[model samples]
Target: MTGDLILYTNPMSRGRIVRWMLEEAGASYETRVLDYGTTMKAPDYLKINPMGKVPAIVHKGVVVTETAAICAYLADVYAEAGLAPAIGDPLRGAYFRWLFYAAGPYEASFGDRAMGIEVPADKRAMVGYGCFADVMNTVEAAVSQGPYILGETFSAADVYLGSQIGFGLQFGMTEARPAFTAYWQRLAARPAYVRATALDDALMPKTA
Candidate 1:
């Protein structure tokens, strides 16, 4: 594999999720550490991601931003590596459903709880997650049936959603339910997860 995958990221950020995904995809990538207020927001990087996000990626002259989008993009581009479910596969629906659910409602609920913000009684219906309890319950159900999120096959859904689950529990934004603990334990055994953790740890000091 060519080392043409360019990852623009900062240490101690959501970029770690993408790093784990790259390892899982077995994509040879080069990381470009971006200082928060400097290189990350500068012209060149801004051109790549107008929002000035650290976890963007550039490959084969194409740019992808957003952690979920990036993970899904890599899985599709490196399809031969089998990190994603094929387009017509029935499991693809399940993969996308959980992936987007994590990116949207799960994240929203996590943020809401972490900040101690409660949705207004009248506005609850307008909220995508509906209720934080729903988010946790759904996640618990999904992880309970898993060797991975997709069941038996560890897809990109596991990487993105699993990372969020890890962060939420680690930061005390969410509860440490039995299913979450079990799923995380299984995820910890993957070589990709280990390599990703080590690489990010090594780069942390340099970027910090």
Candidate 2:
């Protein structure tokens, strides 16, 4: 808990997701706000992550990249934060499922839709997301059974999925299906989420 935590990020990017995770973990961290243009392509930051992406972390001398990986790592490292299910717990499997699903299918499908890329139904198996409709339907079914992803208890999976749903609704990229609407409400009620979002809001410009 006494080690240095340097989070390289831009306030408006996916880095915000890791910010929520940091708040949920109750960990002390420093933000090195990297702007999207030349700053991200600079040599020093590129060494940390070849992709030149934000949401990368340097904790206790180890560097972690990728938003979902960072979130999962923080939850496991700060076990007392109770952001993850216990190792042998049955819920652990489901926790991993949603986390990976959000990073994989959900993100892939969102990009495909936004870019207007169409995958033929016969070749859908070659695409990671398969189909946009399938991805949406699966997520809707999962959240509909919830107060949380694993039922009853909140976990890091909720942070990842909840953020996706929040973004989806904000951009109208995905429908406000009843289950997603309910899940979004549940996640918005979290004190940590409120605090993190307020902090992010303060750091960035307000949009109408």
Candidate 1 per-residue C-alpha lDDT over 36-69 given as tens digits, one digit per residue, 9 for 90 to 100: 8888889988999999877999897888999999
Best by lDDT: 2
Q: Which 10-residue span in candidate 1 carries the lowest summed lDDT?
A: 199-208
- TM-score, every prediction: 0.94, 0.95
Candidate 2 residue lDDT tens string, 62-166: 999988899899999889999999999998999999999999989999988999998899999999889999999999889978699889989889999899999
| Clashes (N, CA, C under 3 Å) per candidate | 0, 0
Model 1 stretches astray by more than 4 angstroms: 1-3, 206-208
Q: Could you say which candidate leads in TM-score?
A: 2
